[model samples]
Target chain A: MRLVISFIAGLVFSAGLVVSGMANPAKVVNFLDFSGSWDPSLAFVMIGAIAVASIGFRLVGENSKPFSAPRFDLPNRKDIDRPLISGAIFFGVGWGLSGYCPGPALVSLVLSSQAMLSLFPMMLLGMWIAKKTA
Target chain B: METLFTPWHSLFGGILIGSAAVLMLWGCGQILGVSGLLSRLLPPWSSSQDIKVRVAFVAGVIALPLLAMVSGQVSSIPPVNGNPLYLGLAGLVMGYGTVRGNGCTSGHGVCGISRLSQRSIVATLVFMATAAVTVYIARHLLGWI
Candidate 1:
């Protein structure tokens, strides 16, 4: 049942990416391209997501035991550690260069695009390195 | 299409994603963190772990879009013209960042930041900053579009 729900949800999420023009690397690249033919569509998506999530989150917090779990799995650590900073830098640099964030990249995988095939392996390698170093 | 984005459309889409995340959590006690789900692939995996939840979480991620398609929220897939090499490089960097940061954009940027998490704020900042720099270097320094 959970798997079924997740599968359906993934389809929705990926479809959203496609509809919102996020799945398109060109569109994403255009958004990143501030100087030339800049596209601000992604900003709208961000704004939209923030607005909805913000309100919904408040509602969810009102009740204790958000789930069967005893408590929320909130991050306990709160330090300006090296891994933290370095990770941010890496993420930003990568986003700027490719405009393909994790969400969109994963969704793009289903398409079997030549780019997705090549990019997927590199992403795996990066993850492997991060685990080792961090 | 109009040059500027429609505010309501953005709002609706955001609401959908955010609400979906909340619903999943409330209903199933799951956090929509992609990295968390992927981490399950690690060794010594225990069956005690909520395999159903993990599978559902991933399934939800993939299914949401197809639902949108059936409802006509999504029209069709668009064209991808970016260089494969650059995309691959970016993917590598992101995967590494996911581990180093301990979360992905959705996890840190959305869930963590929403809780007024200092780490998440820094993570989000780093995400934005690096992304900006990467674009600058790629477009200006490398001249590779």
Candidate 2:
């Protein structure tokens, strides 16, 4: 049942990505492109996502058990750590460069995007390195 | 690059994405962070892990788009900045950043901010500012794109 729910959620999430034009690299990069044809639609994506998720999250109690799972697995890190800042910097640079984040990058795979295909192996390597160093 | 300013469609899609996150949290008691999911799915598998759930979620993410494409709902796949070398570099940095940052656009930007997580909000701001600056450098200063 959990797996089924997860699968369905993934589908819904990807559906949103596709519908929002977020699955398009050009659209994403254009949003970042301030001096050259800037599109602020992605901002709406952020706002819309937050509004619904915030309301939904209100249902979960801080110490309450989940409906089907043992316990909530949310992050517990409280401080603004070094890794977070450095990582965001790197991720932002990458995002600005290619407009491919983890979610949309994976979604683009259904289309067999040549760019994503090429980047996949290297991305794995980077992740592996991060794990080792961490 | 062409700009797609479809606010309504973007909002609708975001709602769907948020609903998906809420579903995962409600059902599985997990934060739906795509990078975190991928990190677990890849190497050095842990003995006690919900590997199946991760696989199922990722499978669904891939499946819907494929189904849509097969059914002609999506007419075409837009080219994602055709330079493989550049994309490879960006992907490498992004992968590292996500794992290091402990979240991605979906995980940190959407779920974190909604939950009022300080780290997530700061991370989101940092990335947004950096991304905007990077774009400025690339499009305005460098004129690469």
TM per prediction: 0.83, 0.96
Per-residue lDDT tens digits for candidate 1, residues A46-100, read: 6665666667767777768654554554457888788888887887777666666
Task: Report lDDT (CA) for all predictions.
Answer: 0.65, 0.86
Q: How accurate is candidate 1 locally (lDDT)?
A: 0.65
lDDT of 2 by residue, A1-134 (tens): 89998999899999999998888877888888777788889888888899999999997655387777888888988999999999999889988887888888888887656777777777777777887788
Candidate 1: segments with Cα more than 4 A from true spot: A1-12, A67-71, B1-7, B42-49, B64-83
lDDT of 1 at A107: 67
Per residue, candidate 1 scores C-alpha lDDT tens digits across B27-138 of 4556666665665544336676676666666665555554555576554443233567767777888777876788776678766766667898888888876676666667
Q: What does TM-score give for chain A of every model?
A: 0.83, 0.94
* Native RMSD of candidate 2 (Å): 1.4
Candidate 2's TM-score: 0.96
